[model samples]
Target: MLTEVKNQIKVVFLSIKYSVMRELLNRFTFISNVIFMMLNNASMIIQWLVLFSLRENMGGYTFKEVLLLWGIASSTFGFSRFFFYKAFSLSSIINEGKLDSYIVQPKNILISIITSDISVSALGDLLYGYIMLVFYGLSIKSFLLFTYFIITGGIIIAAISVILNSLSFWFGNTDVIAETGNHLMTNFATYPDGIFKGIAKALLFTLIPVGISNYIPVHVIVNFDLNLFLINTTVCIFLIYFAFITFYTGLKRYSSSNLMSSKI
Candidate 1:
């Protein structure tokens, strides 16, 4: 068992090393991703500043609270784009017959498909998010609660990305769905989930649960409530496991172009 665990660790490290070298060789793509990410982050920051300046608080959250949420959200978003940008782009692989070569390779096809593209722009978001989280984290008294929220929040973020990427197997044209999901997550992560009411809150907590992922959990963590914190943490883990199971199930029926029949 220990030997198997060590082997898995070696595989993960090898994967990381391969990805780093590939990016080094593809400097042009890396540079482009960074430049585009900077522009995207600058735009988001500008909007956040404008909104904060215009109101004392948007939906009961002060500027600081909004910043905290953005920090958590952006950090998760950056991590997802950095790691799963390849998975999120599975539609292109299916369309271009990239999966043909992937299937023949001995490595895990899904991992290869996911690692093919890395978004370097996410670094900018991560940098700024770290700044925000540190600033807020220092002011907050309950360090343990804050830590729990951050960890669970990360799980939720990863769950969202994996769940959407898994859908590509069925939809085939999942770019639209992925884009909409990105928008919803970004918006939901930037504010307090309490702003939502009734069915809206339920939707945010369930189907498009970006609300519960970051904001709601953070809220409970700040209040130092043990029950809510545990519940949120449990939900985050459930979502993560659920995403993996769902994707694996879908993979069972994942057919390639070779399986398609020619029209008469």
Candidate 2:
């Protein structure tokens, strides 16, 4: 059992290493992509600043708290995209029968698919998150907690994408649905949870899950609530298991194209 776990870890690291090396082949483009994304993320802070100047707080979130919210959201998104980018494109991959190469590999199909590519722009988001953390006042405890939440949040995000994209196996063409779901998750994650009410709140907590992914993490960072932390952890675990189950189950229904294409 221990050996199996170690082997999986090695596979994951090797996959990421190759993906990063491939993206870095064009060093100038990679650097520009990262910088542009960082600037784009940083630009949103100005709007938040303008809004906060007029009001004391927006939905119980002070300007600093909003910074933390962005930090967590961006970090989660960046990690998911950088390490598991294929999660976002799984539907298109499926629709085009691009699962051929992955199916022939001995590694876990989901991990292989996700780590097949890396998003250079997402490195900016990862850096932005740390910058925000510094602005929000860095402490050893807060930094450690933030790292923990980022991992859980990124896993949940990837799991959600997998679950949504896996629908293509049954629904034929679900690229649109998967894209919409991904957009909604990203949109909702950037805002404060206090702004949501009733059904919206419930939906965020359950269906879309930006609540636990972003909101609860913010709350945990701010106040360190044990219950919310545990709930977030539990939900993350469940989502990961659900993603794996859904993907493999759908794989049984996958129709592969026999096109001869080399994997990078």
Candidate 3:
């Protein structure tokens, strides 16, 4: 079992390494993509600055807390995009019958599919996240917690992506549902959870899951809580397990297009 796990980890790293290398072949383009993405994200800070100038708080989020929220939001987005951007297209891959190549691979099909591509621009989001962390209040503990949040939060995003996109198996095409869910997660993540109330807040926590992805992490990191950490991490683990179950269960329903394609 240990060896199997080790091999799987090896495959994951190797996949990411090669994908990154392929993108790095054009170093100038790669750097430009990262820079532009960071700049785009940074531009939004201007709006917040203007708003905070007018009043003390927006939805109970101080400027610092909002910055923290952005850090968590961007990091999770970056982590998922940089590492598993292909998950975003699960709908197309399924609906268009593009899983043939992945199905033939010896490595786990989901892993193979997700790690097949890398997003250079997303590196910016990841970097911006770390940068936000520094502005929020950098400490050994805070840094560790922030990193933890990115990984677990990224997984939550990916798992949710898989869960929503996996619906393509039952329904002919679920691209709209998948895209809507993605937007909801990304958009809602940037704001303070305190702003959302009643049904909206409930949806974020349960249906959309932006709460587990960013809100809970931000809140806990701002003020660490042992029990919350355990509970949050536990939910993330469950999501990971559920994502795999969902994909494979849907895989069983996959009708191969037999479309000839190459992975190299």
Candidate 4:
């Protein structure tokens, strides 16, 4: 047990180190990211202002919860963009005959494709989200929950991205699908899932899992439920594995069409 624990710690540390390296590498990319970051930050503030203007609270949540949700959403958005930007454009990568290049590489094609197009501008979302989280009275327990929230959100986002990308294996072009799916996930992440009802809420929890990002967990935090937390955590873990399996299954279908057409 001790050995397993130590190994897990090492793995976590390595993951963190690798992520930091990727972020550092992103610093030297194009200047356009600065403008994007600025706009994203401004948008967060504007969203809060707009929400507060109508009423101090929407649903059962206050302006503070709204702000916190925005922060978490933006941060998750940025994190996804930074780490998996390539996943967002997998359809194009497959359609443009660029996936063949990845196939020739020694490393894992999916990881390489994903890491190749990191978006630093999303970090702006992360920064602003964290700041908003702090300003809205964050406690230690909340902080722990927030970490779990972000990690789970990343997993679900990755799973959804892979599922969307897998479409490229069979379909010629899936840009519209990818874009629409991304938009919905972003929308779900930004608002409390409780605001959604009936089929909408059901879809968010099952098909999207965006509700797990903030809604269910936030509710658990507010109401203090250990069972809910455990269930959600387990679900996130399951989703992560589910995503990997989907990607690998899609990989089996990825063939080198002619000399150029392929998804690596």
lDDT of 2 by residue, 97-214 (tens): 8988778877778888887788889989988988898889899988999999988998899889999999999998887888888888899988988899999999999999999888
Rank the models by TM-score, top first: 2, 3, 4, 1
TM-score of each: 0.76, 0.97, 0.96, 0.78
Per-residue lDDT for 116 in model 3? Answer: 82
Ranking by lDDT: 2, 3, 4, 1
lDDT of 1 at 102: 61
lDDT of each: 0.66, 0.90, 0.89, 0.70
Best of the two (3, 4) by TM-score: 3
Q: Which candidate ranks first by TM-score, i.e. highest?
A: 2
**Best prediction by lDDT:** 2
Q: Could you tell me the lDDT of residue 70 within candidate 2? A: 97
Expressed as tens digits, the lDDT of each residue in 40-120 for candidate 1 is 755776786887788787787777777677777776677666655665666555544456666676555555556555566
**RMSD, one per candidate, in order:** 5.1, 1.1, 1.3, 4.6
Give lDDT: candidate 1, residue 141. 55
**Candidate 2 Cα deviation (angstroms), residue 66:** 0.3
Off by over 4 Å in 1: 1-6, 25-43, 46-54, 94-116, 137-155, 257-264
User: CA lDDT of 227 in candidate 3?
Assistant: 80
Better of 2 and 3 by lDDT: 2
